[model samples]
Target: MDRPDHDRASAFDADSRRRVQVLVIGGGQAGLAAGYYLRRAGLDFAILDANPAPGGAWQHYWDSLRLFSPAEYSSLPGRPMPHQTGAPYPNARHVAAYLAAYEDRYHLPVHRPVHVTGIERSPDHLTIHTSADTWHAQAVVFATGSWQRPFVPAVPGRELFTGHQLHTTGYRRAADFAGQRVVVVGGGNSGAQIAADLTAVTETRWVTRRPPHFLPDSVDGRALFELATHQVRAHAAGDTHTGVASLGDIVATAPVRAARDSGLLAAHPMFDRLSPTGPVWTDGSTWDCDTIIWCTGFRPDLAATRALEDPRIHLLGYGNWTGPASATLVGVGRTARTAVEQIRTLLG
Candidate 1:
């Protein structure tokens, strides 16, 4: 990654430096959620986001894609996402619009196009260096969600291939790959959805390392949200790390089968070997593709704050933080209200 270039000395004078009580890094859903609470408490804070607008990760999704979660469950604090005309799942554009609205509604102070270069702790405060300015604060909250970086597996001859290769972030619409052989890698929701979308205009194949379990949008006399909430609560009580695995297990119990069974999709195991020609399957089968879309998921980037000697930082819930004092990762299909309440208590 490239470090941002900014004339730090010319931007602010010694006495005119901008300072806040708290600095929130990232202006995505998580950051906005935290900002909502902070605003309610009348705390002096500022949010720095890399994107030009709010809604964070949603803005980077494919234009044709819709959220896997319905609008009801997707709204942030202090605002409701508007309904769409189609299925319960709102499309990507709607989500982006909703996020923009959330920022406007709450008047969240988010500085856009400000890439965070580094996070360092001073003797009396934390300094957040961005592309254009440096923010000083008594405390810092990292709301830079888990998807900061895209993971593309390294395959020999990957660059030599003539086909168009893209991570899920760069994917836009099906028209871009019309009439081409497309391979959607990773069995996660993004991979599945991208495969489904491409199939309309091109020959598509879905590949995964492990056969992922799929469930209908609805399950067992209740919505998936209900089940997800129950699981989240259980995890919050004590269990951790098994939340994703547990959700998959529960989804497998449903009578609904894999979406691939509809003849619209083909399932293949992990890519064993790769050549410029195509990816070789474990069974010695070969599949030719003109385009490769990797939706393999993401990892948390704490490199900027690696020097901070805070073990509690890792304990913060995914999307749920017990205020600035405690942390919990609560956003992977879970609500952050309880975590927010906990933070309020600690801060109070």
Candidate 2:
């Protein structure tokens, strides 16, 4: 059985520096998936998570956030997520529970609330510096994902806008903006879902660079994952005509579909700049908004990897820059397996 947090902390305190064969960063879906493979490969590895809890970034998501795919389709390697009660697409809490259970089932060595500060690479090994201790490892798997690095595009006169502004990371629920007029910026799934989420509670305007592209209602995350897989295979085979990008951007989830069908989710064109009260268009029209919610996407939290460029260090689950569909739960398993395989070869 795994020791309690206090026992683990005491152990780390006794010896501030430790050695491991491998170190996996960010105990989210990707890191856990990597742990699964590392365990099966008989590698001595430990997962370092910045969060205090087992659920990783999922625990921090908004209450209403749901997976794009069903439970069975959104699972990590070696385990299928348990079906959620009453909901085909599981919510954030259910996902978090499943992840916690996965961690326990595998008995993966995970250190929590241990923030990694930086890493220095030598000719033979990597020295990892964290808030809790120092670790020397033969290799490092960076599965930090992107939740910590939310990206918001710069719009003109943003500083002059006196109203409240927040990224999707800070948004919890629509009721928080109950009586306010809100503008949700971005045209992706997040913006559409959040705009749809707000329609019942307050006035909301969805802004996008172009008209929002809605995938067919029949197309969900499963089909999208298959398409991405096919696209990746095609690219590897030297054929770049896979047509994955041709499929529309947004997944038509239940709420998004309902809002769109009711005409409450209609999107507006991107504004030229921001005014004191709200966003202004090139035509000099402006809508008064009490708050601005940027549903902009995220960048990979890879700051620690900047100081070193070593082949022993591999990155997973940061979107296409690492691998196709790598950031998604179902997609991360393949990437994690590949990463572990490479690590095995290097360690041998």
Considering every candidate listed, which one attains the maximal lDDT?
A: 2
Q: Residue-wise lDDT of candidate 2 within 1-348, one digit each (tens)?
A: 224642353345554467889999999999999999999999999999888778878888887889999999999999999999899999998988888888888888888778889998888889999998889999999999889999988899999999999998998899999988999999999999999999999999999998999999999989999988988889899997775667799999999999999999999999999989999999999999999999889988988886446789899898876888898989999989999999999999
Model 2 scores worst on lDDT over the 10 consecutive residues at 1-10
Each candidate's lDDT (Cα)? 0.64, 0.89
Which sections of candidate 1 miss by over 4 Å?
Answer: 1-15, 220-222, 235-261, 311-348
Best TM-score goes to which candidate? Answer: 2
TM-scores of the candidates in the order shown: 0.81, 0.96
Evaluate residue 264 in candidate 1 and report its C-alpha lDDT on the 0 to 100 scale.
Answer: 73
- lDDT tens digits, residue span 63-157, model 1: 76655456766666667667798767677678767766776677777777678888777667667788887878766666676666788888666
Error of 1 at 27 (Å): 0.7
Runs of candidate 2 with Cα error greater than 4 angstroms are: 1-13
After superposition on all C-alphas, the RMSD of every candidate to the true structure, in Å, is 6.0, 1.9
| lDDT of predicted model 1 | 0.64
What local lDDT score does residue 166 receive in model 1, on the 0 to 100 scale?
A: 82
